[model samples]
Target: MNAATMRAVQVVRAGAPFAVTQLPVPEPGPGAVRIKVHACGVCGGENLARLGLLGVQLPRVPGHEIAGTVDAAGPGVTVWKPGDRVGVGWHGGSCFVCDSCRTGDFVNCADRRIVGLHYDGGYAEYVVAPQDALARIPAALSFEEAGPLMCAGITTFNALRNCGARPGDTVAVQGVGGLGHLAVQFADRMGFRTVAVNRGRDKEAIARQLGADEYIDSTEDKSPGEVLGRLGGAAAVISTVGSSPAQADIVQGLSPNGRLVVIATDHEPIPLGPELLVFGRRVVAGWYSGHAKDSEEAMAFAALKGVRPMVETRPLEDAEAAFQNLGAARFRTVLTL
Candidate 1:
């Protein structure tokens, strides 16, 4: 391959397999910077685009959690320079003129774009990212560790920190995979009485090791709500799994005026009974991955607290395998270049 071209994995058509092929290493456009990718983390949301569910344009590269070094910068891109360690997450860019952006809530901007879905992303050796989407990676964090933090890490960390669960309240993290594991750590570290709710006894040991003070084995207990109710209910439940039933089961376990903070991108609607909301004044809300500044803060917090994600890595050429193994990754997956 010449200097102008680089290897990439592309989904040539919806519902089709990812193909390893050559594409021109993109040059940075206006207000953009070109990155020499060191690592790109796989995300569950890619399944939507891979199956044509996200209405993504064909022949796109699919990845959002990216960590790399800036190799070039375009005009008007003063915040980033060549050789800077950086990362980009799901919130690719937004129209700064929108009311949401004007209010400092770019995630809600009508013109907000998502990495991998709205445009090409970090599934290649080089990706051109908007300057506003970039976050500086700290020198203490490795590219592999920082890659997943760009999306999964920031989402879980930001959601729990802002979810209204007090430091001493009983906070339950429903699910012990991917996002839930991190949620448990954050809840415990943040001084909440952390509980891990998972299906089997297999995760109990790890949950305790991760600082969860209690474990709810849903498979053996059958009803998570009943189990949680017996423990005096949770002040907040961070629902991280995609299963609607799992989300529904936890509602009865919420303390009066408690919240169910939904973060998983599940397509199925969570069935909610009106009584659950009316009787207790309970609330359900969703939180998206934050902007670059939030991502930076999440990284710094993780670094300070020694919070790390369990990741399985594959070479860039094995991107297809990395994508396929996302479920079995135990927590998260990263492709290294």
Candidate 2:
């Protein structure tokens, strides 16, 4: 490989095969930092680039769950320095003068910059990002482990913490796959009575071992809502699956004032009756991945509490195959550079 160029996998065209190409190393601009990416997680959210669903430009390096080290700090950048371990997620940067940023709600910024969507991302040997988009990686966490935590980890962790469920309250994580697995762990560690809900009993034992107080198979005669209702109803249900009907089926399981947090990206409208929400004050809300500080906190919590993601690793060269098989991965797939 040429010293001036880096090998990266890019979506040369929307809805086309990923192309491995050599590109010149990028320099961080003012207020930005260049990262030597050690690992990048292949996430379902990459569809935004793969399918061009978010107006992502062609020939884009697509990845947001990035874990790396600062290799260069651009002009005017001070908080980050070379050799610092860091991670970057979906929330790349925000216009500080925007109303959302002024109020400290950068995630909701009107002109939020998404890492992979708005600019070149971490599917390469190096990536340049705004300083505010970087999160410190805990010493106890490896690059591969920290990569997924930037996206999946922070999403579930932040969602569960903000779902308004108190300690000892019933909190259920729907689906035991990629995001669901992490949600179960976070819910368990957060002091809630964690319940793992899935389609079959295949993952029941794993769920229990992951700290779920109970497991519910949706295929059983009783619906998940029925089972959760029998168990006193869930104070919050974190729906990690992308099926709207499945999410809708779990609403009746929420206790009075219970919240259903949707983290998965599903465009299908969730059908619901007015009585279902009006009578119980139930809420269905969507949660976007959090900011860099939130990612830092999630990593620190995981490092301190032994919360880890079950991941499959592949070399950066195999990103094409890895991304193609992401749906079948154990939980998360990390691309090692």
Candidate 3:
């Protein structure tokens, strides 16, 4: 195609197939930067645009785990310039005057913009994003490695770091999938006694290789909570799966005053009892993907600690197939342009 036009995969309607169309290369508005997208990870979060959840408009490019270099910067944008490597995650931008932003919680801003949902995202050759939404990718990370780190990496890393579990605490990572796999590594590097809980023994070897100190098979007659209780209970459980029953079942595994941090998204309500929380002062909290600074920190930590996500790369043209098999991917799937 010409320089002015670029290939983009867009969801034309709710639950419709992704349409590969030629669109004019978007120019950066004031305080924005246009990126030459090198890689974008296909995440379940794309369902927001694919299914039109959260009232997303039609004909929207769906991708938030973006990694690339700045091609151009708009007027009034000084922090980022052309050729600087950067990545953008779910938190696109926030209204600076909002109460949440004023309190330094941009992720919870009254008017928080989400990448891919608010505008065209990195499911294309070019994506324009707000200046403040850019996260500097460390030199050690490739575009493919940095893409998933923007969302999956940040969500797991940020949540584990802020989950109030101290070093040496028993931290169990539920589901050794996309987020769980990374969470296992982060938990180990963070000095926690990491536990990997999954369906069977099939992933035990890999989990241990990823630094999990222990493995619990959920399919066994003994529940995950019971297994953890035998090991002195877990200081925290990071639930990376969207199964509500599984989340509730793991609650009994928490030590007194233990916390359960849920990062996976599901509409079903967790059937938790008052007794469970009242007896041990346990807490069930949810963590959203972090802001730009958080993403940078997560990437830096991953680079320093030699933590990386196992990803399968596909050509940009295969975005539909990649997204369709997202859940079945070994861990993460990235679309390379």
Candidate 4:
């Protein structure tokens, strides 16, 4: 196939605002595959990338939630073929020889590159993905419906699945935006007593529709501890947001021995009372997206459980506007190529 330049959203300088323009479509390099993007989901991390937080490699593309067909494959790329449908998430690639990779845990690979930052990402029509990080897009789902899962879906899915969330356990999803919404659905299918914890009762109906068995509006009841007291405490509380205020709100809400898992946010200087950790308890942290295989398993499970993201799709050229809108909107946005 003849290669041609394509339109892309590029942040050409660090600490400066982003802009959109055309750039030549990239060719697959060694151990890589060039994906003809179908849809690219805007992520919160991408905003961080935009602000030069991920080491500020400009001109940056700043998108990782990718889904598309493989248009070309590079030497040593054995896993994919031209025209095959695939998806890429936050994890772009990993050093295969690293200890983590040797243990089949690519997510922990020390030299891993994030999709939009470490490597050129999916905000354009073509994105170069590492052979080891690509996951097959399930036939049951469409490009738009499947976009956010590449990141939001797999990350939240891996969190609970990896933590051994079992049936009938009480799982509380704190914040019902991008990640929290899907977490509720996953918890529900796992047979957990799902609880959605958010700021207002406004999201109650929405949370319930996503399979939350109960809702706790933190604004009305600032004490998540008292609110969760009604459900007898949660087996685990997944704080989807990392802002200091949000972290401070839910860290103490976990049950005795129950864990608090934080993902994709800056939940640092985690202010916790010393008394909260007196027992044989813990607060764990992890990335939401998993290995390529883990992503595939997450997709299959979502398919089986009827868990899907509620997304809005816009044309690829509108990526910049879409991203800005994403920062303000209630639901996640997917850019259709």
Candidate 5:
């Protein structure tokens, strides 16, 4: 198979709709591999792209949570062989000579490329990526089931796990949306007492059903912060809500030494009263998607705990529509080739 030609979804302009066009498949460069994409998950990042919020260069594919198989390999790409199942996430490729890469902190690399944003992504029949960003998917995992973890999964997993979550800690996930729902499950399975904090009576049932031991309805009775305070305050607040308004309401709920892990949106400044941080000793931190350390661990944990996203699949041609659906607060959407 020459595999010289393949199809992909291209974003030609920001703020306008995306189009599915057939483009020549990119050959893997040195330390890279070409993958035949079986599935790619739509993400909040695409939502940002569609709205021009991310401000990425126009006309780019917009998917990072990718799952597929290696069809070809570039020179020096020895970790993967042809036909091997694999995945690529948001941290598409990094400059190895950078200080961050030298320190094994590829996520903070000065010259990092993001799939779909910085380069063409997996929203197609085939995509190519640096071997360092690739993780071998488990044999038992299906492409659809494993796709979301590449971005969404690894993001939440890294945020919490790296933040020092321990068994039996009170982990409150404010906003039971896409990331919140997954965080609840991850925390529950990881032995934390999970709390789902949302602003309505609507999410209570579903939140608990998704393994949240506690639900705080911010819309009624008390604000989520007050509710969290009543529960003795959270040991850690993993905020999946992107908006500052949402985060502003819950920031005060963190206990002394507790952390607020915010990852939903960029440029949304989270405001905290200086006294609160000084008195309560709470910390507010933001996390990007993932590095190899966390992504690799996330896959192993997903396989170990059966933590797959509650995904809705759309055809590759419908990627733009899928982006709309995802933006409308629709849960998980995976684009299948």
Candidate 6:
């Protein structure tokens, strides 16, 4: 591919694998910035696009966790210029005129455009993004590391920090996968008494090393929630697992007035009994990837606290394999350009 065109892996249709193809390099429209993508993280939900579950347009590039440098700027793009290091996440861009945006709650903007879903994303050598969607990448964080932080890191970090849990309070992070790993680190370093909850002993050591004060392996025929309660009820339980059972397994374990913050995107209905909520005053809520400024704060905090995701790198040509190995792999996948 020349400077005029770039290589990208596009999903031609639902249930089909990504096809490596060449396309003309996209130009930034008004208020946009073109990034020379250095790295893009492969998220589990990207598979939804392959399955046509995300309602994305066909023959599209799918990726939301992106990190790179700006190479060009569009008209009226004053905040960012060429050579600026940046990353973009799921909350791509919001309509500034929307009520949510007007109130500075861009995360809930009714007209939000989801990257890789509403528009082309950084699953290519180059991707153009709206200026407002870009998060400044910290120099201390590598492009590969910053890539996942845009989505996985920001989602986990942003949720935990804002979930009403205080330092020294017990916080349980369910699942030891992509999002949970970062959640564990943030909870630990942020001064919370961290508990890592997951099935199997394989990730126990890793979780503890990542700052978990306690590791709960749920395979021993004990409810993770009950176990958490036994160790002094958790003030907050962040469910990062995609399984419905895994999420249900922790609802009853929260401390009185405890909050359950869910960051996973599982479509299955979460079983919630009214009794559990009324009896303990427990509440459950879901948080999506935050706005670009929120992502910037997350990146800075991760850098300052030395919290980083366990990541595995793959060549862009191995995009299909990387996407296939998402959940089972010990570390999140990052595609290097």
lDDT (tens digit, per residue) of candidate 1 on 85-155: 99999999989998999999988888988888888888999999899999999888999999999998899
lDDT for position 148 in model 1: 91
RMSD in Å for all candidates: 1.5, 1.2, 1.1, 1.8, 1.9, 1.4
List, residue by residue over 234-256, the lDDT tens digit for candidate 6. 99999998777777769877999
Estimate every model's Cα lDDT from 0 to 1.
0.88, 0.93, 0.94, 0.81, 0.81, 0.89
Q: Tens digits of per-residue lDDT for model 3 on 1-337?
A: 2498999999998998888899899999999999999999999999899999888888899999999999999999989978899999999998999898999999999999999999889999999999999999999999999999999999999999989899989999999999999999999999999999999899999999999999999999457887887889999999999999889989999999999999995779998888989998999999999999999999999999999999999998898999899878999999999
Model 4 per-residue lDDT tens digits across residues 132-161 = 889998899888877888888988888887
Q: Residue by residue across 266-291, what tens digits does model 2's lDDT show?
A: 78999877787999899999898999
Clashing pairs in 5: 11-59, 12-59
Clash pairs detected, candidate 6: none
Order of models, best lDDT first: 3, 2, 6, 1, 5, 4
* Clash count in backbone of candidate 4: 2
TM-score quality measure for candidate 3? 0.98
lDDT of 2: 0.93
TM-score of each: 0.97, 0.98, 0.98, 0.94, 0.94, 0.97
Pairs in steric clash, model 4: 155-288, 155-289
lDDT of 3 at 63: 96
lDDT of 5 by residue, 73-116 (tens): 99998788988988999888789899988998889999998888
Clashes of 2: 0
lDDT score, candidate 3, position 189: 98
